[model samples]
Target chain A: MKTKIFGAATLWLLACGPAAAESITWWVPNWDEEAARELVASYEEANPGYDVEIVITTWDTMAQRILTAMSGNNPPDLITELQSRIVLYASRDMLTDVTDWFDRDLAREDFIDSALATGTFDGRLYAVPFRHDGSGLIYNRDMFEDAGLDPEQPPRTWEEFVSFGEALTVEQNNVITQYGTAWPFGNLDNAVVRYLQLLYDGGGTFFNADRTGVELDSPAAIDAMQRLTDTILTNGIAPRSSLEIDNTGLRELFANERIAMFKGGPFDVDPLVDAGMNIGTATLPGTGGIGTTTVDGFSVLVPGRANNPEAAWQFAAFIAQPDSQTRLTATFPANRIAAENERFSAPLLQPFLAQLDEGVPKPSAEGWGEMQRILFDHMQSILLGSATVEDAMMSANEEINALF
Target chain B: MKRSTPRRGFLARLRTDKDGEWAPFVLPALFVSVLLTVYPVGSLVWTSLTNIGPDGVQFVGFANYVELFQMPRFARILGNTIVWTLLTTLGALILGCVAAVALEHRAVVLPGVWRAILLLPWIVPQVASATTWKWFYSSEFGMLNHMLMTVGIIDAPVAWLSSALVVLPAVALVQIWSTFPFVMLMVSAGLQSVDESVLEAARLSGAGPWQEFRDIVVPSLRGVLFIVSLVIVVWALNSFTIIWVITQGGPAGRSSIFSIYVYESFRNFDLHRSAAASVVLLVASLIFAIAYMARLRRQS
Candidate 1:
């Protein structure tokens, strides 16, 4: 009788302890963790029996960490990967297909077509985009006025762009005191994206219609490569030091008044405004009367090995809603409804919003990153005068073709 | 004890039964080593032979190795690895030996403080050092260029990290700076084992400082130098932090090394190729490791 009473007391004590809760781990870039944490809190409040643990990760090591986790079969239930990497992950079978969620839970028409296109692979949706980012020209108004150019009107054609750059460049005794623009001539993301924009503006495609062969040796590509190299070598508008600069470095140089103009996305507006700089926005210059730019962004994905994929999808869907999207200041929302909020239509983001109509997503082929590296190296060679534009483009074309 | 007379042979005593007394202590360690070291290495080798990609893992034995060998970049990358390892290792050793010998000399003052100061490079984190070096090498606003310009050394600022011709050497200089301190500390510790009486005898024999160093000091520190060199060779061969932070093997792959090659492949999601590259690096490192072990055995 005493043993039975003791057993009953142990069972009661065990029952009195906190209940076991299903937990889902979410990994996101460090930039948006504050808003993500708030979303996670709201997700937990709405779902009583589930808990969401958000882990902040940095861009430098995110790919390595994700690969390691996926190989070990211990990846987070939910992760926000750059749009460039989502297709790579899906191709590797590391992400789950969530086509049903788009069809049932959310109205597919509510998202911008270009933003939604980033998450699809082979007619199946493997991720949902939360932000939309694309490059544009951000010029210093004071420098524009100093150059005797109209501060309100920006260059629309390639000829005007070159002239404006030449006019804005300040030199003393043959040594450039102030660069007209920041052109990243090295193996930087800015250079790669800008090259893509140039290619698009010239009405060129990276891959052929069937997506089997690269068309880098085409006339449009040659033109883009030659123009980019001339911007540094012949035009002397951008500094030679740009060969060592990245996208972030470009922005920093522009902010420090080392450069008068540069290219960046909507996210750069806030910092420049906060730093008390008079900045003006303009669409990226076009080649043949068609202004175009490359769009790149981040998407949320549920890992294939997620213990509770349903819960992870629920959290992803929740974050994609207009309410949560409105809070993101770092990037413009991909959701059309959220992007229509009064905050995004301000003068600072007006040019970027107008650019959405002309923004083209980067090619989502496998081995695209490697192809980018090849293109970057060849472009650098051309800019450094080690290789001619035609030769570099031909070599890049061959290397990219060999990737498949 | 009762069954001792029934033992079959001396060789039979080597085999331990499952319930043997040493099993509890030895089994855990053996299990852990197999789990951590042996299993992973085996897996790496296995993965190198397979195409573990989007379509899932498939057996493609030696295809990855063949492809790696055929790639034009592989030859350049291998040559770069050799050049980088030899230069960085030797550069560090020479600088380290010089500093160590200088500090050990009787005429030197504030020996303790000097030794500590010399060790600052190795103690400081690699990322911080790389970042500082990047700023110092910046073409527009670097301290080095600014100082050179101030001293009228050059009419124009040199693009230290941008130009392909100068990038590899520039990165190697940073590697040399960061790692020589480690060599210095090791050599300094090794110097404590050198006998002062032998040096005095050399001095009494009318030997000058250079001759004494060449004859007495080098012979005495040969063993220490050898081990330090071996450690540094392995370290330099596997060095990634300095190069990756500085160049990312850029300026048209002028500074590309074996480690960076492998890392770039992995970053591109080419796992099989990366594994093959790592295996090649392992083989290179293994040659040095075997030499080190053989020398160690001979000394013992």
Candidate 2:
């Protein structure tokens, strides 16, 4: 009888013991740490027997660290990475396909087309974008008024942009006290993006249809290059410092009233507003109508070696939901519904939203980084007056083609 | 009458002998060095001879090196590296020697305070000082341009970091600024050991200041100068932060150096190319290191 009783107790313990909780690790950028922590807390509260860990990454180390982590034996279950970088990992087989989950759990029509396209490689979804943005014409309204231009009316065409720039420029004693505008030619990525925007707006594709070579030698490309360089060299409206400042530096110049206008994204809105600057936003001026901007953003992905892919997908899907996206994204959320929220509906963001419809996703080819670097070098040559626009474009085109 | 003593084994002797006593303590460090430094360097060398890609690493001995050398930009980058290294080393050495000599003069007041002030550039963090200097060199809003224009030195701002013709020297100037203080400190330490009696004897013999400095001071500081030059040369070769933060070796690779090329290659996921460049840099640095070791051996 004692042996039978002990056996019964052991059976009861075996049946009733707490199950092991599944743990998932998620890596997020430092900017999203707080929101991610809050989301993790709520997720843990909503679901028992599951815990999610958060690791913070920064801009300076994100690319190399992510590549290293994904290639290692143990990788985070989930990661928030730049959308442009998702295809690189996907091409390497370092990511897990989530097409089924995306199709079943999310409404396809509710997300921005370009944002969703960044995560799709060879007809498979590997990531879910949360933030999406493109550049718009961000100008100081007061500067426009002070320069005798209507504050409400921003430039609509490329010619108008140059003429307006010349009007807004303030020169005293041969010193540009208040320059018209600037480009982010100092940074490789920024410089490339700006050039790409022009290239696309002028009807040039960075890569050929089959993605094996470049079209930078096309007439449209040369025209775009000429126009961009002429802003400083020919128009003489922009300061020479355009070659020394990135997007952030350009925004600072705008804030200090040293410049009147520049191209920037929605993320620039809040800071400029908080700084008490009367800013206006408009779609980027094009050769014809609204110009096309390069749409880039952040997305959540699951590593191929994740131990808890199901839980990771679950959390990723949760984050993809409209409300969660709204809370997490500093810019416009990828979900159309979430973007309708009052916070993103401010007048400052409308132009960016409108511009998104005409946006093309940034290129994510395997060798795009190197190609971009090559293009950046030649673009600098054009800006520095060391090479003609045609020569620079042709050289960039040949070099980029040689990469394939 | 002879007494026989038992011969100690190696292990037994290691515990008692003064020289051998350090063996046990050093084993851990030596093992760590082999594990950390030796292993990584071996891996770098092996990686340099292959093409690493998404599929797998393929052994392509000398292929990566050949490709790197065949590229036109490689020649330009090599030239930039040599120029940058020589320019920075010589500039720092001359400035450091001058500051050291000037501070040692009896006519200089509060030499310690002046030394501290001069060391400020070295004491400030590299990233912080480089960033500040970048702003100071800015063409439009830079304080340097502002001051120069205000003083009627120039009518327009010079694109210090943007002009290809001027970028290398501009970045080299910042490199010299931050490193000269180190040279000064080393030279100052070397100057302290100069025999006061010898200097006085030269003075008594009616040697002018320039003559004494040219003949006595320079000769005595030869060893220190050599080591300092080697150190500065190695530093300039390995430099990344200053140039990266300032110009990013840009305006069409005008300031491109080997280190920047390596980093850019790595960031672009061309690991094989990056490793190859790194191996080239390692070999270049090793030459100086070997020279330094040889000098040390000869001196000993």
Point out the worst 10-residue segment of candidate 2 chain B by lDDT: B11-20
> Highest DockQ, which number?
2
Per-candidate iRMSD: 1.5, 0.8
Candidate 2 per-residue C-alpha lDDT over A1-404 given as tens digits, one digit per residue, 9 for 90 to 100: 23432343344334323363668999999999998898888767766676898999999999999999998889999999999999989988999999997775666677899999989899899999999999999999999999999989999988899999999999887777998888889999999998889889999988889887889988988999899999999998788888887888888889999989999999999999999999999999998889999999999999999988977887887787777888999898988878888988898889999999988999988878889889999999988888999999999999889988
Best-performing candidate as measured by lDDT:
2
Q: For residues A1-404, write the lDDT of model 1, one tens digit per residue.
A: 23432343344324322353567899988998888888777756655666888888998899888877877677899888888777777777778899996565576777778888888888899888888878778999999999999989888878788889999999877567788887765545667888888888887889998888999999988898788778888998888778777777778889989888887889889899999999999887787453787887888889899888876876777776776777753678887778888878788888887787788888766777678888888888876679999999999999989887
What is the Cα root-mean-square deviation between model 2 and the actual structure? 7.0
lDDT string for model 1 (B1-300, tens) is 465566556345436444575577679999999999899888888989999645678989999999999886778788778888888888999999999989987898999999999999998999999978987997876789889988989889898988888888889889999989888888888788778898788889899989987887788888888988888898888889888877778777878899998888888878888899889888888888998999999999
What DockQ results do all the predictions give, each relative to the true complex? 0.43, 0.73
Q: First chain of model 1: TM-score?
A: 0.91
> Over the full model, what C-alpha lDDT does candidate 2 score relative to the true structure?
0.89
Scored against the true structure, residue A404 in model 1 reaches a CA lDDT of: 72
Model 2 DockQ class: medium
